[model samples]
Target: MIRIAVIGQSGSIPEEVERMAEEAGAEVARRGAVLLTGGGSGVMEHASKGAKEAGGLVIGILAGDRTDVANDYLDVPITTGLGFDFRSLILVHSCDALIMIRGGNGTLGELSAAYMNCKPTVAIETSGGWAEKVKQTAFEGCYLDERRTVEIHYAHSGKLAVDRAFELLASKWNEERNTGVTGD
Candidate 1:
């Protein structure tokens, strides 16, 4: 099964952004993919809620060993005990693809990690934060650097972002297969 991580801002967020994250999580569930997040509040909580409501498995890659700090919607809490930055890396590495909503510095770091690892990522362009800013700041408008490792796809809504992530994942897998890269 595909594992899609939703990377975004924690703490207070706009209502519209919350809705977008929730919809994205629901769409991931509907498509039979597992939803992964930082396991905090704001975007993570909203997305987890949507995934749970849609009967999807939600995994939270928490920062500490305490499950109490994680959002209430998590079906499984992976207490990394590695703190936020390291835990974020685990979250990025474990997922096959990512959907970025309105994000802050942490989300930007996640995006960078995704690009470095060549993970398929779809950003909600209208959700604000790094999701919106990355389009203009990225090299040639998609890559994180001159390497052009992976093209970050952009969508206006959560559903579309999830759809694009799936498409990108499919294409990546096909390419890997055609190139004899087994990806094992």
Candidate 2:
């Protein structure tokens, strides 16, 4: 299954942002994709909740060994015990694409990781925080830096964000297949 990870802030968030996260998760499920997250609070919790409500599988890449800290909606918790920064890499590396919501430094790090790995990313601009800031500050409103390793896509709504991610994944898959890479 296509695995999509939603990365965002872990603390309290505005109600609308929560709703956006939920919609993104639900859209991921409706598209028959597995949802992955940092598995903490705030955006992670809300996304997991939405995925669960939609009967989607949720995987939480947790930083600590204690699954108790993971959100209640997780179908499986991969307790990495790798701490925040390292676990963030695991989250990025494990997913086919990433959906970014309102976030802080942690989210920025994840975005950087995605770029470095050439992983497809969709940022929900209307959710505010880095999701919004990244669009304005991105190089030519696309690449993060001069390297232009991978361009990040922006979406104004949750469903659109997920839709964009799927489109990106499909294109990437097609490109790999055309090149006879198999993408395994």
- Models 1 onward score TM values of 0.98, 0.98
User: Which residue pairs clash in candidate 2?
Assistant: none
- Highest TM-score against the true fold, candidate: 1
lDDT of 1 by residue, 1-184 (tens): 9999999999999999999999999999999999999999999999999999999999999999999999999999999999999999999999999999989999999999998888889999999999999999988889888978889989999999999999888888898889998654
What is the clash count of model 2?
0
> For residues 63-180, what per-residue lDDT tens digits would candidate 2 score against the true structure?
9999999989999999999999999999999999999999999999999999998999999998999999999999998898999999999998889999999999889999998999
lDDT of 1: 0.94
Local distance difference test, each candidate: 0.94, 0.94
Query: In model 2, where is the ten-residue run with the lowest total lDDT?
Result: 175-184
Q: For each candidate, how many residue pairs have backbone atoms clashing (under 3 Å)?
A: 0, 0
